[model samples]
Target: MLSTSMRPLTAHLCLALAGGAFTCGARAQQDPDGTAVLDSVVVRSTKQERTLLQTAASIDLVDGQAVERQGLQSLADVAQQLPNVYFTDFTGSTPTLSLRGLGFSDDESDSLSTSVLIDGVPVYGNALGTLFDLDRIEVLRGPQSTLYGQNSMGGLVSLRTRDPGLQWGGSAQFDYGSGNRRRASAAFDMPLGERTGLRLSLGSEDADGHVDNRALGRSDTAGWSSRFARLKLLHTDGAGGEWRLGLHHARREGGNDFFVSTAQAHAHESAASDAGRSDTDYTLLTGEYQRALRGGQRLAITLGATEAHWNYWMPLSQYGGPSGFDSRTRQFSAEARLSSASAPVGGLDWMAGAYASRMDKSAPYLFEVPGYMRSETTARVRGATAAVFGELGWRLAERWRLAGALRLEQDRRRMDWASDQSGYFDSDGDGVPDTPYTSADRIDGLRVRDSEWLPRLTLEWTPAAEQFAWLTLARGYKASGFNLYAYTPSSAATPYAPEYGNHVEAGWRMRGAGNRWDLGATVFHTRLRDQQVVVIGAGGASLVSNAGRSHSEGVELNAALRPTAGLELRGCAGWVRAQYDDYVKGGEDFAGRQFPNTPRHSFGLALNWKPADGWETGVSVRRVGSSALYPDSTVTNAAYTLVDAHVSFRAGRWTLGLYGKNLGDAKYLVRALDARTVVAGAPRTLGVRASVDF
Candidate 1:
């Protein structure tokens, strides 16, 4: 186990900064060529393709090369290191992301605060099983319902996979890592015919876990194996238009991420250490078309269909072992967008679009607990949503701009639950039966209907090229739904209310005189109404409820510097205060406490260098502050710092590399329940890699 001493790191950074070897403050992208010439970044995830200087929102980028150099395996690894964005996983394969301290909870019905998109297809909650074969990842933070609908009340995540270039090319990589881990990946792109191209990529990894399972006498209890493949076809017209068809599939089968609580972490022993299993399978199909119309206008359309299946089992009973669950989800979505490509110079430009989606889910369970609990049940649920949105930007003057957007959305949900089990003792109290819920029950066709309006307004001032300042206000929502599980005697038929948020932000962007330094900063505050919360009720059944209100305020900083040739330093940091403002739950007030899964301070820094001799090296350091685990829960996780380093050399078309992660081998908690159950993070890992391009 690594010791908790980070003082030396701080001293080292201070020395470097004092010597002018490192630069700090705010977010920016520097020249990759070791020159002072900076390049503009075009972002396509914010419902439109706009340059970073032009977009009035906070965004983070993890490009393909960075992905390879860092060996990023999951979304959690990417988000937590960005300024105000954070990611956590209590369950091994499920990823929960929060921006500016919002996302939390594993309950599926909470209405995902953040919406995920691959290419142009929306992938609700199951975006974690696959993070391979990508061109870039775009994280847009803040309320986004004005364009993405309710699911994006908090933010949006977009992942774009590699596309075949106009010429034929490909690359392949293989590596061996700590704990007998191994991975292999390859990609190819080629011209198929006139004006057409095809690309294919495949990746797989398997590893013996970091934790030991004493009860099972296994050194690698939480092992994992994951595989993903993607194929894409692109067609280009002579008239500056394009269309793409994509198919993606991924699978993960392995041990769950649960680890013994730090309090009981000795020898990695746990109450249920010997019996656990988890797996996930996901697939998506997407088609997108874009055309430049004849009358200085453009048209865009996207179509998507996705299916995800996941299951996990934990032997809750030491005697007869009773527990297992599986869930399946399918969704179809489509969107049509139109924008004016040519507007009068220094005048008005606008865009409009409509979106539609239908989703279906079936979650079934089978459990048997010797004499305590036994159940075989299923929750069948369906939901549909539709919206029309538009945005108009007016160049009020040479240096001023005004933009506003609105979305009218409607959503409907239906649920049917059936169950069969053992052990029930309904103690009648106040007309509600107490549990040891026994009996076979079936409930059908419970429904919920909701409608909401999402709106956003912004004003931006550009005093000089590559410099801008903006202020924004937005309102977003998360639709309501019938409970998937019933903790009460008969309230499974009732539904929960919707969750809403209003946000305000102000920020500035600037590029230093020589383009050698660039920075962006933002201060934001959000008011949350009807926050969804999951708690335990009668018979230890899970229940979903609402908190009256909460508030979040934070400042985000991103900065970069290219002091000399082949060297670049970039860092992101944020300080947040999140708490329930008004809380009355069951007539009990729990206000004045911070939210669970939220930290006060988060920061990350990285250095990239390619000195000479075909050699390249990089170092990254990140820290996440400690915080409570749940609302009103006493459990907590200690803050931890992670360090990753890599060294590689290129010869002709081949590259050889070495890498290591979590050098400190810190024993941090990614998840905790009560004070006795917690999940441990990955330990130190090292690897050697080889790659070649053709």
Candidate 2:
């Protein structure tokens, strides 16, 4: 039997499918040349540029124009339109992302299962702050370890920013919305010379959030403000050589009291006596040089450097006590590669690359429970990585192609940690601390080293133009790390093992005649050894541990149709079953339990229309299924649906738009730590935006 939430989604899917069938048959008889074809999207996820239709991997591409039109502000907004993707934003600095049920649920910055790339440079922590002036976003599903090394076991998100154009032009936009939200952005491009160009973009946003704090008598307790600036310079040598340099800086300050107890009657209401605060900032610099050689071959060298910092003080106890956290990270990376151009030479395509990176990080955490206890811990880590990777593709027959990729990687890390405990102690074991005590521990010169060989094989069959089918097998890996928040000496001394994944996937994609429609489906299965998971340790501290074994399997489907000129319909659905095979923690056996924070079902539908010149409208519906909040816990986040719509009018060089999100006013949980500590999702919001191009 279908649940109430599932019924609506099922109905929407059926209607979309039926409409597509009817439109396909009816449109086949019309003038094919008169109808516009779906635009072709070029992606560079595999270290090479290729059309999405020609790529032999499962990928989702989101256009920058669509992002602006629909007012998609963050990656979480974009995830709603994609299949088998989930995001949980626990705080401004800690965001958990998962693809195909493979990601960490807790606040572990060094153990991300999914990797986020900004212009080919990997980002260490959250990537939400850099969502401005984007050219496109490519989400590559499944493991990409063969090309991207570690931390890419689940998938990769690649964001490409817009570059300078040949002509001088600019655009400006302003937006106002609910909760006193305000946003302003501008982009300018200019030609410095015949062969050189430059682009600059600036944006800022501020909002008095929706959440109300009764204890503090505040209406917008979760408000936030952010600002970002980006600059790019492009120079062409006019001899098949080019040089590009980019600089980006972003900062965000917001309230850290987003979590509330689940027992509250309203998710957006809080009773905290202390209104917390958070601040984060990051700067990135990147440079690339590319040269074209003979025989359609190209050589490229890239360099990147990043520096980020985060600081926050949030209430951790019901008695209005605050806990403080501070983190700082720096990374430098360089890569050189050579690859064959888009046109295969002698029916063969190949690429080879070498990469090196160095990172330094330090974090300190202080937790206080008012008069009960206080613990402080500081950790410092230095890590280095080196890898060599290559990929080759061969034409086996007129309609068949075979490809293989391999990567040899080595990671080394050194750690220095210290922990201090003070305040009352439970000396009598009566669940009460009556004696005051103090203890301290230190760990130094601890080192970990890991080496892995990741490989992937794919067989593709192209039966017709714009049609492709492929099967792939790949291996993924994530390096080990120590627990930074450990309070006890034994817990601080322990380290988790590396995780390994074996994955298999099969997929098919096709476009209808005249490009009026398209359809794609994929099935995947993955098995993991020593899966990394978070567990509650002594003193109510969170620690990363390794699970014995686990597995995840799922199917994803997507379809799009243009029934008539100026009208389009799209739909996507996904189902996943992820469970543990053998796992025991703290004397509890959870062999067959489902993975936490992984939904079993998800679906989406969208309709876009252009009724007349200078007029556009669209609506989208998304449904997310229920899932457990923690391993072996009875508490679950219930299912919920969201609706978003937009309408715009354009005249001359000016455009105005009205958009609304979560129109149904649905209340849901985005993150939860048991029933007491929970973070609610955003509520309904409506806004208006205006933009002008010159």
Candidate 3:
């Protein structure tokens, strides 16, 4: 356990500012940071760090204070809270997130379209499924390819950790809840020596299943426990230069969620004889150096390495389900960056980096056939990519700024497949011992030239001291092609093409007097080409393909208002329609159908109050509209609403909280389709926690 006496970096910054004795009256209330002061209320859209009234993109920022106040479970909570973002999880830890009606096309075992990062280091595979030492999560919407690589075609979720400083401090939190849940977390920071500091953060969590599997005679749900710890060391020289190193480790094991078999679907009982199980271990090491070059020029360099191992056993038994599968994956990545900030040319800022990564994955599963026929498949994909990208922001004048970014990238993807099959019926009508298939390894190659120039232009006119309005136009892009999962085919088949899209958007942002109210809105149209999708093959095999053309257009509005001191209200609403102009599904042409899982309307509201006394309370409500589940418009999920509430009290160095998630007990489906059964949503639950700092 670490102590709670670490000093905050912000503390030194505040002290320095005060020592400077720069008198800031209402001006400080406005543009406190001369370079550009971003509104504490809005954190999305622009790289200039200006208020929402001056941005050109659509972004949703979640602060560290908000994370604590809401007691969010995972990135899932944050994703669902934002407009135009939706995600599904068969289990609490493993989730698939979507933006503006994309994402449901990748394998359940590999990296997701929505890239997830913890402190600038990418978290590959299931390691991203967990949250341990997270401080703030920023969900940047739309095409972020200009700044990020690979999956940025959809968006990116960046998780920032607390920085350590020279001081002695720590915090501890403990929680107990329904279903015999128990969790504990602690963090500490200490000054090792003059100019050197170290900090450690650790957490452990375990909980029983909330859903029951009646046919299995017990809850085939999940009971997972995990521990994560990070140690960081920092050093600074007298000349405004700094260097830091960090080491992180985490391990998790639990009964993973399993699904029903095709035969058992009608019974509403899963095929898992015993609850499933999964194990994951992750490790990361990082180093960063920063220094001032010359004449108001600054430079930063960062390097890191990461490794992770993940294992999953669905059903876990032969009798559990003939289709139960197991998977193992490992990945490695490295990046080198060189960039300068705030060069002399009038409010100009720029950054550029080059990166490369590679991965190997294999999955083997049981077949429906007995002894004479057993099958195993493995797919290995290797790739490398490099990009030089930069965003240049120019302050046109005191009331205007222009920003734009472009990236030229090339990704080469190659895959090798191997499979084993025993003698079995020729279900595909291909004669030969369809059952006992000979194992074969074959390879395929594909490359994409992804050179994109995304530009963001913003025009702001501040007519009043405390109020301003701005308009913006921005473009974003997704990377072309890559294999998201490994498959063991009897032999290698045709390669799938890449999918990418672009968004043209316009929006406005405004903030009220005294920083009491904030409102931002955007209207945009997106065209996606070569959209990827998964189709079921004979005998439980799956194949990936690309749809010809599709378009999605919508509007979104986000607002945060503090009508009274110590109380804040935040809300988001969105309406979108996504349809396929030309789609071929199940050997049929469904040219004018709506894309799957795209809701027409979604909205959420949260009310938070911190009384002048010693108490804080919060309540929230969310609603989602119905949408089709396929490009053919053959299935749909009904509209639903969910409610959550929490209350907390503080005394001395201790704080206690009582919370109930899904307070309405709303029984809704998280994922479902006519062809594919539904994965049910969680039911109502209550929990309590206590934390102390010293």
Whole-structure CA lDDT of model 3: 0.57
- Candidate achieving the largest TM-score: 2
Q: Which candidate is the best by lDDT?
A: 2
TM-score for predicted model 3 compared with the true structure? 0.84
Candidate order by TM-score, decreasing, is: 2, 1, 3
Clashing pairs in 2: none
**Candidate 1: segments with Cα more than 4 A from true spot:** 1-32, 35-38, 45-48, 147-151, 264-275, 316-320, 342-346, 424-437, 487-491, 586-588
Tell me which residue pairs clash in candidate 1.
26-558, 26-559, 27-558, 27-559, 322-368, 424-438
TM-score of each: 0.91, 0.92, 0.84
lDDT of 1: 0.69
If the candidates were sorted by their lDDT against the true structure, best first, what order would they fall in? 2, 1, 3
Which is better, 1 or 3, measured by lDDT? 1
